[model samples]
Target: MSDLRDAALVSKAWPFEEARRVLKRYQKQPPEKGYVLFQTGYGPSGLPHIGTFGEVARTTMVRRAFELMSDIPTKLICFSDDMDGFRKVPTNVPMQEELAQDLNLPLTKVRDPFGTHAGFAQHNNARLCEFLDSFGFEYEFASSTEYYTSGKFDEMLLKACWEYQKIMDIMLPTLGAERRATYSPFLPISPKTGHVLQVPMLEVNAANGTVVYQEPDGEKVEIPVTGGNVKMQWKPDWAMRWAALDVDYEMSGKDLIDSVTQGGKICRALGKRPPESLTYELFNDELGQKISKSKGNGLSMEEWLTYAAPESLQYFMYLKPKTAKRLYFDVIPKAVDEYHQQLRAYPGQDLKAKLNNPVYHLHGSDMPASDMVVPFSMLLNLASASSAEAKETMWGFINKYAPDATPESHPNLDAAAGFAVRYFNDFVKPNKVFRAPTDQEHAALADLALALSSEEAALAAIAKKNAAMGNEDDLPVADFADDDFLQSVVFAIGKNHGFEPLRDWFKAIYEVLLGASQGPRFGGFIALYGVKETVALIQAGLNNELTK
Candidate 1:
């Protein structure tokens, strides 16, 4: 196993080497005692997808690197730019889909289906925050709405309008020709009309203190916008954010090639060096195009968490360089399985002696082993079928089976509780989505149920079965890994309860009741779902099978 920090270095190409170096660069040293702030920003257009985290998580990596590079602690900040008037609605926005018919009006005036978040900005911004929290990151989150009203970027805003535009003219041609045309040399807003001056975008001269509004197919009119100024347009916003936030590093996707290139101009204009940036790849769902929410296709980070472990995500983040393109969810399950293998193999390997090599970071930190946990889909099935399963209830079960299970204090237990509630409410899929069971699967499950008649019996059965499964030996799967643990879990539930050892019986319990067999311990999960429904699922499924 290579060091985790050295994970992405496969090529000798300049860009690849530079990225690897940037990834390994020192920010922790003394002359720069200031905390390394790795920043992530998103335009509050709509619900942010996994790609959003793709950037933030990379920022986390840089922060993690800084922590490792020296004694200096690094901080990660995710900025949500909610103040920017909606650019053409994101392809993910549902309401904006219809509103594009209105020619990309201000999102404020448009009706958004997703409530709780105010306007397009608020709606999407809320989703991003919720997603970020899911990753268990510790960071200060700031919204542009707050920053704008709070006047944090006031100076940068002023500079963008005053100085950013001048830099854009110089930088735009370098990015491409179309950019030079679409971008206004300066932000044109009317203090009087309080509307963006679009047609004659250049009419209002904040310099001349003049407001010019031109109606479509109408003569140029003048309107005044006094208080409505944020100054610089798009690139300026990027520049000002970099300087104001003191961001030493930020990660943007390849999609922002132009904006990032232009952002450099704005930074130079602000008389500051642009923060270090890495242009990572964009992700498309299984269909292989960019993930789009409005298209009803994007697998949100919420969805990813439902199916994959956080460490799986962390590993997948660097499985390829940020410059490469196209990642799919289908790849995660296997990677997660392999990640478990590496985690188990890392501790005993020569990696410990290789610490001086600087690649020790690629392998994860030392930890006790666990079993290969099942996919999120399976868990959803198990959880959905059995309603009583408390998350900690399952956690408690794992403690009984696995040796290293130390319970968190009561406060952290609250997190598991919340996770259970949401897990059952939103994420669990219906029985219809299940890939039909195979004869071998059915037989193995029944055999597993029989083995579960008692803990010792179940363990023995798993040990026997381990001879056949890939790398399923005594080695623990991962942090949450526990294949044998799960086997005992389901068996225990069936033998103790009336759930029985039959295929139809367990299937019903798993389908309508538990979202997966390979999930939280059946006993604890059953307690959360309750005895009646758990029993009912077993009884009803058998009845349904008999009738069919």
Candidate 2:
């Protein structure tokens, strides 16, 4: 839907200016130690959505830049409010009385009826942390559960609630929402009577005394007046977070635009410095709703690592400002396409380079990288192998065609490739989605079946004779540009040989041979074994004993 030039990383409307010379007032600090980055992610009712990590990942680039910007340590802190009561049920996980009772609250206090979390909020917090680290996010993580239980943030929370009245006045009107009568700046559940109530706002009483919220139901509340008492509401909390952690920048989704509005007001109320806020529209599914784990509509970042490279995904994130409009989820397909296309744009050069340079941000995320359809020959050869062989084999080919798949071609790919391979295995798996033959290609399958049944072995010998191909790693790199013979046989064999292409081929080969398509590349992959072993792979698939 966009005819925007690739030069702008898909910014059709406005050109991005990554060249801001002067740091804002709040961002100023000693050159040796750069901005301290802190971001919020994880109630962890289930796994974090792509949107959640999107914020962290975007912030990471800034941190890395700051890492280069500073001589001293640049830090990122990922805070998880695991102590919050579970607000709602996550799909696929069972909901029960405990969940209903704890609804509209943080997840740390909820009971996992599915029996996975095992009667604790801490388990889900761990899951969220695991998920974040899995996405290659570098963060110093903290949990609200630990923070509160250990009294690490008691002063802050107490102060915030103490100034609850003033904070509420500024925050509510800013968001245009009225506070509920029963709502308190803080929520308290009576473990004894199962009564949930909010304390009434405390009056300062014009005296030197600690004031706290009083409930209409008759419980008198008070607080100790002396300490480093400072409080802020949600709106002001944003600014306070910046001042507290010395945040340089933060990117939030549009859903938080109102919160930021409210937050900005709080900053003014508290007379504290606020962090600069950048807003990206939330990534949504085809149904056009925000991707949320609670709604079961969001896919995890780890789920995305499969089927596409992480750099490609990262490239996808950077192509446009996170604050842009129309941030489509389907953009990933475009992202993938551009990655492949860029690889093909300069065949024989290290393809991983395509993922490295800032130029990698040229397209959207969902697109496949190349237009050079994976020669059916390569896919067929791969499908007729075992998972280990297929994994080894395919990675070899990808590393050859697209250098970004392995770190040997480019060191940055080292961590990224390992993630890509494992993500595919765990999330997508060898059998996740089948590469079905096209309807227009009906004759192809029948002809392929014939080729396999007859004249196949002798032809296989001919294919072997015509080929010295190993894993892409071992395949002799050459300018085979005009080599029609090599191309012909490769595609032809694919037409008559394997049922799966690159992805499924690896998956099926792994399934039939090693029981998974997730090892090394195929060119060198087949070499680790040999033709006889490769032939056995094809036979195994025909026999349908998958687990074997």
lDDT of each: 0.53, 0.48
**Backbone-clash count (model 2):** 61
Model 1 residue 502 CA deviation (Å) reads 32
Quality of model 2 by C-alpha lDDT: 0.48
Superposed model 2: Cα runs more than 4 Å off: 1-22, 26-35, 70-72, 95-98, 104-106, 113-120, 149-165, 175-184, 188-199, 202-218, 223-239, 321-337, 340-356, 359-548
Give lDDT tens digits, candidate 1, residues 1-548: 24433443443322334344544444344325366667788765566766777777666655554554345466777887655554565565556556565333333434566655446566666667776786677788887656765667665555554563476566666655665565553444434444444442545455654445454546565533323343345666677778777666777777788888777766777787677777777777676788654454656666656655566666666555555545554565555555566565555665333332222233325453534333233334343553435665545433433345344433222333334435555534332333333444444445544444444655655455455444364732312133445534465334433443444445644543233443444545444343344445544443344123
Instruction: Give the top-scoring candidate (lDDT).
Output: 1
Candidate 2, after superposition: displacement of residue 321 in Å?
4.1
Candidate with the greatest TM-score versus the true structure: 1
Candidate 2: tens digits of C-alpha lDDT, residues 253-320: 77788777776665555544455566777666666667777776655566566545565566566655
